[model samples]
Target: MLIGAGYFFELLCTGQLKPVAGQPIFQETRFGWVVSGPADNVINSGGWAASAVNLSITENTETDLEQSITTFWKLEEYESKSVYTKEEKECESHFDNNINRDESGRFRVRLPFKKNDYKRDTQLKQDYIKCMSEYEALEHMERVDNEIENKDREGKYYIPHHAVRNDSSTTTKLRVVFDALIAEDRRDFQHVLWRPEPTQPIHVYRLNTLTYGTVPASYLATACLENLANTECDSCPEVGELIIRDFYMDDYLGGAMSKAGAIQLRDDLISIMSKAGLELRKWLSNDPELIVNVHSDNNNIRGRGQCPDSQAKILSEIATIFDPLGLFGPVIIIAKIIMQKLWQIKVNWDDVLPDNICAEWQRYRDGLPSLNNLRIPRKIISNKIVVITEIHGFVDASEKAYGACLYLRTTGVHKNIDVKLICAKSNVAPLKIVSLPRLELCAALLLSRLRNKLIPKLNLKINRRRFWTDSKVVLAWITSPSGRWKTFVAHRVCEIQELAACSEWSHVPTHDNAADV
Candidate 1:
């Protein structure tokens, strides 16, 4: 017998039953006919029973395929927050108020602690003692005994420290790092180190310079650099500007076009940093003669053996290629497409890929070694004197991907023209089917952004800037009023116009557009 409830049972029962003697009955229901009753042949065994089984299976095929594509292309959307937080503003204010220069010309800054009542934990105190003991031994710290603690002032704060050991380090294997994040406020910039032995007196040492690993350490250091630049801007403006722009934390990555210019920049850097008790070291350059006097060492580390054939391994190989400027965008786009396919198929991290994908990955992996044979010139512009300088950016798009390429076009005093590719960027198309014109517009927007970024960082003077595209539709949309079109095209056109003027955009034949490659 079949059992159900509500409308289902009513519908099943609201049918005529056609019965025949010595045969099963057939009932006509809303969902057509249903067979009922028993088998024709019965076993002659006693206490026998029959049963039936039914399964209603359902499957969901919906997937956000665009998410996988966006992830593979690293096209992340970031919400812009307030530029400065309350803590950051407080840190900046503290630096501005307490910062000073000693008679020796070295800048001095106080630690910006958030709270005054914080006390060091027992384990932290022990670590601080050990770190201070080593500091005293190295003569980097001195013991103080004359000054007594003033009850009117805030309580003393202790910064905890720990050692970080590097087995591959050649000079210092163990480095003691102070935890500035956990530091508290205090009137006196002193740390007390108690010796385990009762006979030895407690030692108090004042920290003079900016403490590393502190919450305000980076801000203080950066502020000091900026102050130094401002102080020396009247005399060495270029060096000052370089200090503000080129210095990433403590490392400087600036360069000059000519040898004499480089030597001057190096000297100015040394002089400016010396005024603030900072020294530039480990100087390295492509021109060996520039740093010939600096000692250098070579250490070769072997790479791990070939990775196993798996989805995870393919991703690992893809990440190993470091093309910061997207110079290899064309080649890398292929790998990105493969990754998108893997994501679409919902392959587990370590699961084996489909045969077709695996074969494609292996071919791409094997061809990567051939990339070493390709060499690109470091300098985009020629050494000869150039009378005219221009930046040309080309944008193109296909069904699979869209990209933009920027080239430096220079004309020498002799009217000799030279064009070299400076930078290029590409992104995989969204999985959602989009019109080709829309992708071309995206390529144009990418080109405009690329130009805006490249032009500012370039030290060379650009006489003119031009943007090229193979799509006439994109050109018309850019030249016309942005409000005339739909939201998608209009928004991109507005941004493109803001970055580059409508006149700067022009149409190029697909055959001539370098980005088409």
Candidate 2:
């Protein structure tokens, strides 16, 4: 029986179990290998007896018996080893004290949730809190409506009678609700107006000029719009878009006012407020904690019916409502994209260093008078001043190449105090540096540098120090009245004008200027 059982086990292992109902075994080696009934064989006690076993060639000949043995053994006695994670353990520990609690010594199932577990419930609880807040605000609004209705019932329509209205309690409550909502959104009213860029970190709030102040209210609204969905006030559009829309609507209603006009009005209002010694705009722009003027237009006939200034102020306030951190990610990202696109366009090298002056420089350096014999020596010129320009075509595009500028000055109109302007390029190009044109600029920078660096060393006390450039355009720009040169080259012209503020700037019409050497 053991032999037969072993034989049967071998057949199962090799997967060769096949039998004809009444057939005898064909044994080649005369070893006992016979099929038996369940009644006779102890191994077949679990109903392996007399069963029709079928066998067919199912797989390829190169199957691994060792791997099959390992798989069968693993299936028979192996138990899956489960690893409990830290979260699972923590959950189990939490469940031990809360979920699986013993009540009256009986395993009482906890129904669902406790009062303190409102946060655990995702839907109903959050909705309930939001609804409650809205209801409170609505109730406050309704109370204001009720007070107005009572006033109407009393027939108080006259100016004096209407003047004695009292809705402070309701108004205060409404403000509280709005403030709470603002807080929830991580937007603080005061913060929006004062936040700076995260990377540059320049404090915009501190830069207050007579013309403009630290972050405008519209800027704050821009921040809110940028962080709309992520903020507590997700439902509301940014204050700027709404304000602009409202402004357009007002324009539709026979009111023709532009942002520029509003700005002008603000200035006028500031002037008016200053007369009363209550310069609110300046203070508001400068001091973060300064209380804005709420009652400035209360009695003034000029501040009649719809106070535009007050509306603007209010809108500005709303716009600056910022999240605690200042500007959001999306706004910065959009701003960066804009900046990148701007960077893509080729740089204006001519603007950096113009070619006309550069051509003149080449002429000046080639034994010309402009570089050496100007009304003032190059050495005494301010190092900040431009002396000569170098114009060279770029390898990629000749029309839009570099225009290297050089500034030179003498220390005190002395020969030793000479300064030179060198190429602004990374590597020094000798030919470009010492070339006829470049030398003139180099001479200018050298002179300017020398004047600045060596004048103190020389201890020269000249009452009227001057520097000269032969460009008539530059000279005109420097000497022209601010009102006359307002177009075409205002920025550049202003720069030249500023240079003339300290030193005597006069035209040296190409012939006498030594830089033209």
Clash count, predicted structure 1:
1
What's the lDDT for candidate 1? 0.77
User: Candidate 2: where are CA atoms >4 Å away?
Assistant: 1-135, 139-417, 420-470, 490-495, 506-517
State TM-scores per candidate.
Answer: 0.64, 0.19
Each candidate's lDDT (Cα)?
A: 0.77, 0.32
Error of 1 at 16 (Å): 49
Q: Which stretches of candidate 1 lie over 4 Å from their true place?
A: 1-93, 101-107, 113-213, 232-235, 274-284, 295-304
Q: Taking the tens digit of each residue's C-alpha lDDT, what string does model 1 give over 1-517?
A: 4556666666665665557764556666665666665545553477464332232334445334433434455743323235988778887888888888988888877777663221445554555566678899999978765445555446766677555657698976556777854443443644546677889987767555566755567877889999889886678787888899988889888778787888888888888898888888878776677777655443222244454567777776665655657888889999888877877998767787788888887777777767766677757778999999999999999999999999999999999999998888888899999999999999888888777776778888999988999999999999999999999999999998988899998899999999988
